[model samples]
Target: MDSLLALLKKKSTGQGSFALENIKCDFFISDFDKPLLYTFAPFGEASADTISWGFEFGKNLDVNVIAISLVSNESWYQDPELYELALNLGKLANFSEILGYGGSMGGFGVSVYSNILKIDRLLLLNPFSTLDPNIIPEETRFRWYQRNLEWDSRFNDGAITCSKGVVVYDPLFKLDALQAKRFKDFKLVKLHGVGHQIPMHLNKLGLLKRLVIDFLNNGSDFAWFYKASRNRRFYPGYFAWMQSQENIHLTQRRKATITKCQHSLKKLISSKPGVDSVTGKDIDFIRDLALDNESKDLMKAKMLMEIALKLRPEGEFLKMKVSSYNKRLDGPDL
Candidate 1:
């Protein structure tokens, strides 16, 4: 964490600053002398060192950044002092443009605070509109925040009226999609294959730096950003998601969508490294898909289990699965 802070401090020309220790947030005004970018760090990023590290990428864009790190998820919504400090910083900057940015919990902060900050624009990626489970029961991701919610009516209301902004998200990610719908005013930039981790996916694709620069330079012009980020089509995660969608269509008996999905899956499986380079959970998911798809084809299910076992050789659950498949193949008497 010290190293991360040192790296950020070394890159930017401005001196490091801190809000009241009670607020538990950090601020670093970039030396770039460009428009200020006010970024709210996501939950768990409670310190300057632990905040979002994407500021380094934006440094070259000649934008000044004020990275606000929160000590708790409830801090932003509950504390009026934090909001006042953020707004005052923008006022002090005397810059014509001030943009709010964050993803997930941070995204929620950007939306809620940006409205209050009255910043020129916003760039929210998969932001949660409300932490209230009653409003969005399907959103099960942020359980920590959900359980500890302070329930501020000011921020919790299902409305984020940004002057101009873009909400980038994956429509396939049901929770994020629903949240995006709540922000009916912002331009929606749907990146279908990537789930809740849009920034991570974009960083992996080497598009995040350019995308941030573009959005910072040209406020809510989503068309240009979308065109530049079309490389998502070639991403392996995207293809893997397509394959999963096809499998779903096949299960649902959606003949037309199934046919297209099949062709796409086949092409992806043949040429792309779908789920192979990803987590073991994804491999387990494929095994479950195989078992669910071909319950009668014990051989196919066993093959998938073998593959999963190879990846997770000591996985007891997988071993059990393999045993179950073997028993199914051997017959009830055996």
Candidate 2:
């Protein structure tokens, strides 16, 4: 049950660390000349006691970093303690530029506090505008945490304060799309099938660093983002999520969007022809494709699984999938 600051201080004892109520902040000074990056850690059980998001990324770039995290999930950062913390942090003159970055709950913090922190720019991914149920009645996803929140307070609506930043989100996700509408001033990058975990998915596709660095350094490059986003087609669970949407709640536009994505996937698969063999590197891609096909075409799933297993001989999950498909295929018709 160690505090985030305590856990972080174990590795580097001299760094600046502070805790006020449920909020914690850690400061790492890499260079006096480089811009400071403020990263807000998202809400999650696994990362509750870890350093804020973008710790290593900021360290690698030799920039000053302020890592902020809330120890408990109950507070959606509505604490008055933040204003006091921001007032002190805003006085530092080492940073030439002050930028904010965060995702989900973290994104909410970055946006809401941008003006007070004197943030020059920001990068928010799938951030909620406000957790106030009255304002966002359609959003029913986080009721457990929302039940006891003090929503009517200063700096509650991040959409009002977050004027300069890029907001990346999956437009096909109804709730996220609704959230995006609140950030009217910021530029929107609608990435369809990547879901709410936009940053993670982009990282998997080897695009997160380029996307983030380019934005924080040079504002934004829409053409570059669009081109890079197309690589989602090759992501492991991308097509599977797209194809499985029939069972989920989707807007009319989202349904049409998925249909278009399915068309593009079909063309991509057709161009690649058949998977004759798979190398160690290709095993994951092949395995994912196999799983995607399991519901619709068991025969094709079996073939791809066989190809993947040849490269990954010790793959127990692949063996199970292959066996299950074989049994279903060989059974008599009902």
Candidate 3:
């Protein structure tokens, strides 16, 4: 598995070039003292995950490489431990600096690596806020990997630790759906109308080269480079159009769920007045929702307290939920 993992990791890093097909990972060791820069790629529909425009960018500027491919896509979710495992591999791989590649789900995941996994710099493409299976509905392009439970997000404020970040959004991002932090925290370059696809933005190499040159040579923010790129190659109307599409698709799903909830209530109501009250049946339904997957989402259970209040209105269950939710809201490890 380690060898296979290494091979896959290589394909993602690309052998220090712009070749997208036979992605192989290796460092362009230019004198042992050269500053190291780690890079990662987005694992989309499994087609272009190996492209290393990021690597090409860095190596061309004469920087060493430490790249990995815990890419974000529907597929890698099949085994999340692997994602974590790939994530942890950076420790073993040697590098003085860090680089994160963005594509599809990789967009946001790479950014978070700053804190969770710890890196220096990252170049993110289209990223997502959360890739949990429970969030996205079936029939969507992302639905396939949702089958694997590991897609659940384990991110927080401290997750992204890069000193400098460069993010590129689909000129037309679907939802703006991903949290703004992916953009707010770094220098962003949004490309519109592009799907979770990669290779469309291979020019991403330029961004990488600039980062290496600044950090390795003079020690700069690389901020000016980011702004200059944005001003010159600006794409208009892409973000607005994506926002419109996102609203429509997301709204459709929300409406469907509300309808389903209405129908299910009919059955719950019809079965009333059955089995003995001693069975403690009525109470548990509300209690269980609070408990079900409570570990993953304490805030949700808290919000549902209002619904639980409606389910039983006033009862011991309501109190229990409120207390549980509040306790969690305070902080974990409590």
Candidate 4:
């Protein structure tokens, strides 16, 4: 329990960066003077969680951390006063280095604020370019952000300053890939199999702390990240991605690729049951895949629908699928 965590555990006194309108910033000053790491909160997360994660990652190193939490998905681009206050605090402390780090909504915050804060480096994971549907119509996920688009439209343009940055994301997630591609200046690190939750996956493999520490000491080094991410091959997300690839191969009629993917999926399923559990939607998808494969196995598809219905008895979609399958089975062969 560090002093920052202790303070957060107790209520704030409206003192220095602790209280901001619709935002909360927590500071963890280490015993030794070191580079400052500023982390922004992910969607719907409290500043405490971001601070705790930063403390855990930089605990061994001589690093001071400031974690910012946003009350909503506003992106903080509209708030110039908050940025000014952050800049003043950093100058007051005379920190040796300032780095910004975040993921998802937090990533958006870091991208927008780091420039104003004059951050030396940035480490972002699966960040969104903009929630404005007008700018990015494909970005339909965060509706809350879309509803409250009060900031300057130019703010949603892209990364401004902090030329040196490491953006990590999976190309499989189409929207995240799009966002990562929009960053003209940042160095992209593609972690293929892992979805948007790159930090969680890295943390699970016991490599997140090391990666962050290395990045803090050194700048954006892709080689280190590549070596650290080798363990991702064994992660559940990798297996899930492999299953998706298998579906693609099946659709393409690529027999060799399908066989390889099937073998890999079976092995993964055997080792990781939780990852292999078939849901109603998964079964429906498999049913469609079976039909697309041009297989005359209508009975098998019906059985699958039955299994899906059993899994989710109240699922109207599953019921409709089962009824459709039954109709096809009972209808005259044509």
Candidate 5:
């Protein structure tokens, strides 16, 4: 540890600022003396949900690792201490490389933190810019979530000078204007297969060491990531896509959420739960409706709701949605 940095850390006492407050999270600090890499996935309203980034490379990066997490969908903004804690961790760790990790909403937090934290490299997994006004257009249930993460210019480099940023997401997100050149300065690697999660036995820590070794030796890893098979990019399997969409929908933004189920019948059942409003068909629609809103796919949510009601009866989640679309649909008034 550098003596100057040590002294500075000593002077900075008390609680560190954190994004979430409701729960005390587990903060894992590793290899503090070397450049430190920090990772987090803040789910906001969908905090409890889980998604894998399929990075068999997590352990291969070789740099110091600091993993901090709040509960699922729990707002870090609720507790400024978590922010302070993060900063304090950064200070105390004296990290040369600050890396943020996340996908979906977790991706959004990593981007937002780049402004406040001095980071060197970032591996964002399907990150979202939750607060960007564009989020509203999705009309997915997740578009309207806790007010804290709404995109504010503050996190934008235009407003706040931030470190280099990079994104590793599904191009399907189709977000450019909201973050034009957001990662132009950084190395952006899009994983087509989703690389949602590496197998459990990928020697996490050793792999991380290898990545750091490559980065420090040459400052590049296109070959390294490829050679080590650390960059295996595979998305959710057929059934997983269907489940993931629902999993992602309910966990994060429901509007932008989608259905991975290629089966038309399966999709229909997921999207429509009721048989007839009063006559009652089936609750199968709940599966799709939940998956839609949870994944932030509002359009799908509306579609599923329409089919569900057409088949059976209206329910809680749909009632709220139908009321909004009432002016257009003459089917049944809320």
Candidate 6:
């Protein structure tokens, strides 16, 4: 962080640069008359050499850029240092407009500070509404950090202050979906099955850069984004994450169930229990693999179908495969 601060100071041509104890802000002046993109760093993204999240993308833009970052992942930008820096930044040479952008934790930062920065428009990807346990006791993903961080009531909910913006998130990610619901007037782009890392998935589809640029330049086109994101069906990472989440949900559901025998949930549960979100192309692929292996390798085919059934708990083809394969496996060796 010290190294990056030194570099920013060397490149800064205006008074829009400040490095406080926890927060650091730097301006990459391009065209003063053009808009300014204020971007915040995501969690665990602090680097000693690099600026922040949107530095590379900002460089290509006609607007000036302000990259803000927390020195560590400790505080969620709820610090006296950031308040002082925002005050200092407000007094700088004005641009034509102000815009903010970030993903995940950085997304939370952008929304929380939008009012203070007077942001005209903003873009957030999988942003948290608040890490305040009292506010969202159901959010159990980041427990350790939530307990440690100061969830100052003053900045508890960004949705209250962030008036207008574009929010992109996966509807399948229940926790993120809950967070996305807190915002009032923002345009919500539901990219299903992409998981919490929507930016990464969009980037994988070669659409992230253009999406940001187009949204920042004009505004979000919901139809176009959805159409473009259909390509994720071919990406294995999408299916992998979907399967992982399904597994988690299945485990949770099993734990929630109680048996009359009072046995452990693990002991009573089916070994090849099904999961809900394992639908679509992944199921087809698994089904095909299981069928192909059934004639060549009975044991392997049964195992493959077991995995398939776990992903698509209600898949009829998988049920047939399970029945057929189990009978074959039970038969005496020839």
Best by lDDT: 2
Using Cα atoms with residue i matched to residue i, what is each candidate's TM-score against the true structure? 0.63, 0.70, 0.45, 0.64, 0.47, 0.68
Q: Give the alpha carbon lDDT tens digit for every residue of 115-152 in model 2.
A: 88888788888888888888888888789756777677
Badly placed stretches (over 4 Å) of model 5 are: 1-20, 27-32, 42-63, 72-78, 134-141, 146-161, 173-181, 193-334
Q: 1-334, model 4: which lDDT tens digit per residue?
A: 1234344334222123455566666666653246777777677665432342343344345567676776544555455545666566544544567788888877887777676666888888888766767667887686775777763554565455544778888876777888888777777888766667677766654456655766787655567567646645434556565456422323445445545665664543343222456544565575465455325444445554555455456769768877876654432110
Residue-level lDDT tens digits of model 6 in 1-334: 3433343345443434556677766667756568878888888776645566666567566567888888877778888778756654555536788888888888888888888878888888888888888878888877887887778656677877645888888877888888987887888888876677667777655557667777777665666666656655445565566556433443544434422122322222233433333345756776788789766655556656766676667988789879876654342110
RMSD per candidate (Å) reads 13.9, 10.9, 21.8, 14.9, 16.2, 13.4
Quantify all predictions' global Cα lDDT against the true fold. Answer: 0.61, 0.70, 0.46, 0.61, 0.42, 0.69
Which stretches of candidate 2 lie above 4 Å from their native place? 1-16, 45-49, 244-334
Top TM-score prediction, candidate number:
2
- Residue by residue across 62-155, what tens digits does model 1's lDDT show? 5676666665555544566665665555344545577878877777776777756667777777777777787778877767767776655676
Judged by lDDT relative to the true structure, which candidate is superior, 1 or 4? 1
Ranking by TM-score: 2, 6, 4, 1, 5, 3
Give the lDDT of residue 249 in candidate 1.
28
- Give the lDDT ranking, best first: 2, 6, 1, 4, 3, 5
Q: Candidates 1 and 2: which is better by TM-score?
A: 2
Per-residue lDDT for 301-326 in model 3, tens only? Answer: 55445345544545676777677666
RMSD score of candidate 3 (Å): 21.8
* Pick by TM-score: 2 or 3, better one: 2
Query: Which candidate model has the greater lDDT, 4 or 6?
Result: 6
Ten consecutive residues with minimal summed lDDT in candidate 2? Answer: 1-10
